[model samples]
Target: MKNLLFTVFTVAALFSACTNDADVKTFVNANGYTIYNDSLISFQKMIIEDGKVRQVGGEELSEMGEVIDVQGKTILPGLIDAHAHVMGLGFQELNINVAGIETLEATLDSIKAYAEANPELEWIQGRGWNQTLWPENEFPTAADLDKVVPDRPVWLTRVDGHAGWGNTKAMEMANISQDTPDPQGGKVIRDRTGKATGVFIDAAESYVTQHIPAPTAEERRLALEKALEKMASEGITSVHDAGIPAQTWELYKKFADEGNMITRIYAMIGGTGNDFDELSKNGPIKSYANDRLALRSVKISADGALGSRGAAMKEPYSDDPGNRGLLFYEQDELNEMVDKSVSNGYQTNIHAIGDRANDVVLNAFEQAIDEFGDQGLRHRIEHAQIVSLEDIPRFKELDLIASMQATHATSDMNMAEDRVGSERIKGGYAWQKFLDQGTVIANGSDFPVEHVNPFFGLYSSVTRQDHEGNPPNGWYPEERLSREETLRSFTLDAAFAAHQEDVLGSLEPGKWADFIIIDRDFFEVPAIEIWQTKVLETWVAGDKVYGNSD
Candidate 1:
């Protein structure tokens, strides 16, 4: 019966029978929940007018335009993903994705099927192959791929996006050989006899990937649309696109100008290459197209990921002795980049996954702040995955945000401790430690790297466990976040990270009418069942953007 009522509203929205944006519409009988004044509040009635919340209360308010009862549905502020790759997620959907394949044999079969299905694709391109998940837990070889995809060149990126697996055809096309020197901050895996193993890590991926044809403008538009639709359906109304190349920024602008954006995007321009030089010169764009788009942040990659043993650690890996991880840039180079970004009035967000990388990023950020005085720009460290215990408090002291992906902890639990060992592991994905030091964490899923569903992140944050409930006591149970903390991290706190807290984040009177009606109350659901919660309707700026009617 509740679903029927929800469907009715959705259908009405589709035909323009719903209240117009200019009119004051009262939504009644809703179990509304939102974070306000650092507390979760409940409201039964709310009024929305001109794409903003007008009033919210426990009792019915005076009706001004139209009254619609949501029939006792659960409503909450729209989830915000603070660290996602928008274009990458879109491409993952469009290409051959083997994200969840349990074994190498199955993964190969899946790849073979995809190649056979897409016969027109000259180069078979895909991502989301995790070598660690295979039974043998070994990186795949060119021979392994050649058996399945012999004719066409094939390149598959690891799930972390820090490594790439190329078939013999692809490597041959790039003219890779045993003598091919490793690029700075990157490596080409080699066998015992110094022969290329067809695996490229970090910067070396560019050699093989440069040959693939770039997507046309129309293709990019389609991919963006697909990503927006997916975000809407999952109840996400806003996304902090972690990094945007110049081409993606142009596409996002087109969508915003046309008012075609389904989810609000807070984009961070890539802080390197010709795009950075071009975009940053004009300064930051605080807001555009009715707050549907904002480009005021710069994203810099300081190091690689932990999955591929590429994260820059202070000490050598526990599993692989005598070898620490890689840092993408030297200290002086990173300091200059951060200083340039903050000086230009941009919120700088750097990706630092290992202890050494984190240390370097913190130093860079501190130097930038000292030179420019922070200026109220909330600099962030994306994936503060591994940190020295001594450096953890520096986050709070410097007023920097830890833009973390909760699911990364759950996903990396199997190997994180193995890589860093027991003692250093204490500061790995240390949510409680950050919170204890008064550091704010902006949570996300790093979608396509993990799953796109925000609920997956919420569950992981609160439970500190895998979907199947591994380690029953939770992996590092001490680091688990409370339900309220997790919700705030994804909603209000995330908005704060993007500097959109003034106009977004909550159901307050002056906030944007961006919220969602879900099937279950997130606050009341059992911790283990949080991931099962589904979105019944998603509203952005008081308009239904996605619903079950679709």
Candidate 2:
């Protein structure tokens, strides 16, 4: 009886040891305080089991097997860039970046130097030039580029990515002339002499653009991969690719299925006739590859950009009298597209910059909602840069998302005031006002238009300051958002915009283990220093996708 009792005791001890080991497999130390990673509602004590969050704080804590200390590092949800053009990055790097070039002479000089060095290339392509940044702020004549590249055709796009400035050679090659009437929804900037001045806005630029060589498929793939890597490194786990081609969407699907896709993509099909037709026929594709990719929206360009003076404003520009900007799409056509998209189960994301443009889009969306009866469609207004106070309420009433890029507010602050004057400034980039009314904002850096660094967007949203924090106080201080609001715009709200709130945008149990470790806690730091914060590590699904230490 004693020997039997001893054997039973030994077996019980062995079983208890196995149970402890099993518990160890599920432990994670959150270091006491509850983690409000993405949204405050998602606050929990995490149990990291097998590299993924297994359970939240509860009775589960005592049973949690082992604990791995996260120390005191504040872990937030992995960020999402709500609006960006990712494929454009590689092209921007390979071609000339002319967005911020201040002087026509300097722009020509840069092109001339580039042409001289890359004589083997077939054509010269560059983007990122803003005439507003120039001393004269006047459109440059084709004569300037002609003098530099008379032997070769040159095309450089303005900073807003809405217009193009071409040389005389390009105009001749495309058969553009004084007799060529402005295409519908476009303008060919001409001299008082009735000659083409090299600046083409909206649809007019496409005459030259359509002729330029499209990048090869391999080129597109490589550029996308490079852009994804950069996004992951910055702790951006997802992005709403603002205007993507159908072909690019195919590539995204291929990559996602193969597990090569590193970031969650909410792709808004570029509103080309082909893209609209294809997406409409098939209907919305929700959460491909376990909620990694989504395609349910169409992006429509309502008007051009403010920098190019093509943003259809309520009043004429403060600087350029008699010009209130131009609309890219006809009103009737826009309404039709919205109606068709809503009927076909597709959301519409319209880019509207100037006050007038914002009004136009808001009206269209209102009409759609009236007819369609708000089926929880999170329709979006991209940019919404300059708005009227009256139109602001419409965003909430219609349940439309304010898909804004915060960097645009700070970046354009210098010239925006000069363009719109004080009366209009109140409604421009009014983030705080929108939030007060219970509107969700999805923030991003319109990359290639601005830098893709999410920190810059966060900094600008919180402080309304430029990188250097000049001018003593921030720009439009009343419009600035708090740190929490800014973070939510990049994470939780952004996820909600993309219809991905369930699986991502929060570091909660059973959700994908996606989070970023920043060098400093944004909440604790001085507002200005937020711009200087660096991403320490980026994780996706419990795997380290990018890390400085790794």
Candidate 3:
């Protein structure tokens, strides 16, 4: 009887041990199961539990629970746009959109139609008209616009955002004429007989633009929403919005508070006297509101763009003799703003295109660094195009980010060489040189100036060609970046420039689940095929924000 009791007790103990083991195994598997299987070049499978990744590898995933099969798709971290005029793009869409209008007739017709539809509006506002793409590359005269909207004043911008084309009524309203001296860093295109031609470049645009009415608060909110939706659909999860106004910053906060902000925005308040004084009194915002909106930078325009021949060059343009480009701000004023931004713990992003403008910006940044020491402040030079060879190394020496638009090189390739000449072309868009010197480049599209899609950027960076693949061997092929380097510029390097690398820009574990699934694997496909790739879906923080059925 005692032996029988011993056998029963032993059996009971074994059963208890088995039950405890099963309970422990269930808890671990339920809580600890997070995996990312990247076995295919075009797809990746992520397994998550309680919002964090447990593992990421390229192998079987039979053990993973609730498997997300992202098969036959290329997975990459959600793209970051290092430089963009988001508010400007949004506002332009709400007003008149003449982006693709080819001829002068088409531009006038669009304006006439807009005027008829919005009769209640005080001033007619529009943007996006490029004379460069037209049959006649010369600037349009007021007569072209005057024929359509003789009664209504109209203000239209060139595609480069550096020039404006206004009607006769608008020009008259601004009191602009042949005798009106051109603004320091701008131009008023004139006829052969010295009459104003209605085309104004750079600072000259402000002459007519300042007269246009500002959008209402509600209208501004709607524009911001529209911009965010478009950005998410194109695989952009974050943007460094350049030149945001104080009122716009308030609207951004409201949207963020209501959880309506789809894309993370690092806003650079426009550096005006009032803005600087306000910022100085209150101090920089310094990565606030859960890192969704950071107001820690200021944007200053030191020069204009190359398309309008307004970028400040060291020497006169080879094609346009007796004319050097414009500088938007004086050197002394630029230096003061740089010092103020650095002292107040704000990053300074200055727009510099031509060699002379780039030199001035570099000098200011160097001085600021010397005064403040390196606070890990990643100050930036926006559109570092046409940089001098001597100034290229300054980017690395001062730990500055080159926030460049890859498509700029491809788009400008046809005319850039003529503007700077063959001797100076070597220093133009020198991406490879900056990379070799251990500097990080943040890639962007400068949208409304170029396409918002990142593939255009990727294609241009790797091939140095437009969508159709021009120049056979690629334009300035030496400046072309490797496939991996180009991808990094848009991804990891871009994130680092925004000071948000820890959360986004990579698919590693412990990072936010922000990524995109594309139709083609960039690594395995031909360079030309990259531009043709399509984004299938985009996710932000494990939530699918954009997806296409077809």
Instruction: Write model 1 residue lDDT over 1-550, tens digit each, in one string.
Output: 2211111111011122334445668888888888777777777888888788877776635544678788888899989999998888899888889997889999999999999999999999999999888889889998999989999999999998999999999999999988899898899999999988989999999989998889988878888989999999999999999888887888999998888998999999887667888887778999989899999999999989999999999999999998788899999999999988888899999999999999999999989888999699999999999999999999998999999999999999989999999999999999999998899899998988999999999999989888888889899999999888898999999999999999988888778999999888787777889999989999999999999832
Backbone clash pairs in model 3 (N, Cα, C under 3 Å; residues 3+ apart or in different chains), count: 1
Instruction: Find the 10 residues in a row with the least total lDDT in model 2.
Output: 3-12
Error of 2 at 175 (Å): 1.3
Ranked by lDDT from best down, the candidates are: 1, 2, 3
Please list the residue runs of candidate 2 whose C-alpha ends up more than 4 Å from where it truly belongs after superposition: 1-52, 56-74, 99-106
| Candidate scoring better on TM-score of 2 and 3 | 2
TM-score of 3: 0.89
Clashes of each: 0, 6, 1
> Candidate 2: which pairs clash?
23-65, 24-65, 98-128, 98-129, 99-128, 99-129
Candidate 1 all-Cα RMSD: 4.8
Off by over 4 Å in 1: 1-22
lDDT of 3 at 25: 13
| Per-candidate TM-score against the hidden true structure | 0.95, 0.89, 0.89
Q: Compose the digit string of candidate 2's lDDT tens values, residues 81-160.
A: 99998788657866777666778789888999999999987788888887777888788878888888888789988767
